[model samples]
Target chain A: MQFLLAFVIGGIICAIGQLFIDLTRSSVTPAHVLVGYVTAGAILSALGLYQPLVNIAGAGATIPLSGFGHSLAQGAIKAVQTRGLLGAFAGGAEATAAGIVAAVVFGYAAAVLFNPRS
Target chain B: MTQSQGQGNLQQQKMQQELQQEYKQLVKNVKPRPPVLKNTILAFLVGGAICLIGQLILWFLKKEGLGDKEAAAATAAIMIFLGALLTGLGIYDVIGKYGGAGSMVPITGFANSIVAPAMEFKREGFVFGVGARLFTVAGPVLVYGFLVSTVVGLIYYLIR
Candidate 1:
């Protein structure tokens, strides 16, 4: 159920990009700005505004930037008292390393295998 | 050194300038980019799939020797390194080409942002140019991510 939630949540987020592509005249270059969009969404989620979206979407809303933000936020809270100010910088990376590594290895492999046409 | 010869040389110089101007004008006259639905969807799926794989890795690591906390951090570092590497090798761009933002929305994209600019400016000298601009785009994300996360932690504590 969790995996299913993650897949659907993640897939719907991806689908938004599809909608953007079909509806607008934006090029691939502008579309690359997705990192920014996700970050914004995640930050908003952290602030509590995006919670409803996450609840409704399940993993979909939370998985992308919001999930990421939640991870970092938790990390920071964990590390701040022990590490002080420096914890702010290191916490997120420390917390989310597993997910990060997985994405890179598999993403790179996919790049190699599918050789997705640019 | 005759008037006729001088006139011919002048004519050639004038023609050269006109051609340069024409080329510049042509470049400026490009049409606005049209939307590309297919590629964008491809990017999202590809990018999201990357994240999904990251999740699996973390799960595997937790199942192994490491705890979930340690495993997750290890995953981030490895992925970030790979993303930085691919961005340098010009491979990440190719994925971005096909998957669109879908390919970029993951942590790897953030990794690319930090590494790509640094690589580009490596020739411009390191400290001021390359090193400084290296993490420029990523700097904001990191800073903001941290700040937001702190707030989130507070909220989580309060609620749970």
Candidate 2:
């Protein structure tokens, strides 16, 4: 059941992105969509709305770019609660550090080891 | 004679407009339309499949006794690693071509964005090529995501 929900929700979110790309003739590139989704996720999360979706969808909600935003927002909120305003500066990056660091390390290794095909 | 010349100019303008419209129609007819419905279905299936994999990873970690948040973070890292590895193997692009936004919307896609550019720009050398170009696609995501989250955090702090 959890897997099913995750797949469905994740697919729907991706489909929305595909539809936006197709309908706009891709005037909005994939980069824009990715960045936009994260921003939207952060805003939605800040409003305390995205958490319920996260609760329902589990990895489905969290695996997408928006989940990253939720992590950032949630991290900040948690930090603010415990450490005061100073937490706001450090918390968002702290929450997402694992993902970001993994991407950088793995990404650099991949680039060094592999060549792009034309 | 002046009045006649003005009338001819208007006629010429009308003819140009008609020609331009005809060319537009011709181009519209020539261009093949994208398979929107088919693409959307593929995107959904592919995207969902990726998420399902993530969910499985999350579940396995939880079963191993990691807390929920910790499991989630580890899952994301593992997924990113897979994404980078697949991208290096040249498999992810094939998946991306077929999956489109389905692949792009996931965290794996984010990893692909970072690696693809870095690999492509490798000929220019590591410092300027791989290093600088690595974030061409993903830089905005990190910047804006962090910026907005901080603003939200500040707001929450002020409000609560």
Q: What clash count goes with each model?
A: 16, 0
Candidate 2, residues A17-64, lDDT tens digits: the string is 889898885478778989988998999999889999888889898999
State the lDDT of candidate 1 residue by residue for A69-98, as single tens digits: 666665655666567666655666677656
> Of the true contacts between chains A and B, what fraction does model 1 have?
0.22
The regions of model 2 sitting more than 4 angstroms off are B1-26
- The pairs that clash in candidate 2 are none
Q: What are the per-residue Cα lDDT tens digits for candidate 1 across B65-123?
A: 89745765676666566676677667888876776656556666666666655666555
Query: If scored against the real structure, what TM-score would every candidate get?
Result: 0.60, 0.91
Candidate 2, residues B1-160, lDDT tens digits: the string is 6999999999999999999999999998998878999999999999999999999999999999999889999999999999999999999999999999999999999999999999999999999999988898779999998999899889999999
CA lDDT for candidate 1:
0.60
C-alpha root-mean-square deviation, each candidate: 10.0, 3.2
lDDT of model 1, residue B125 = 67
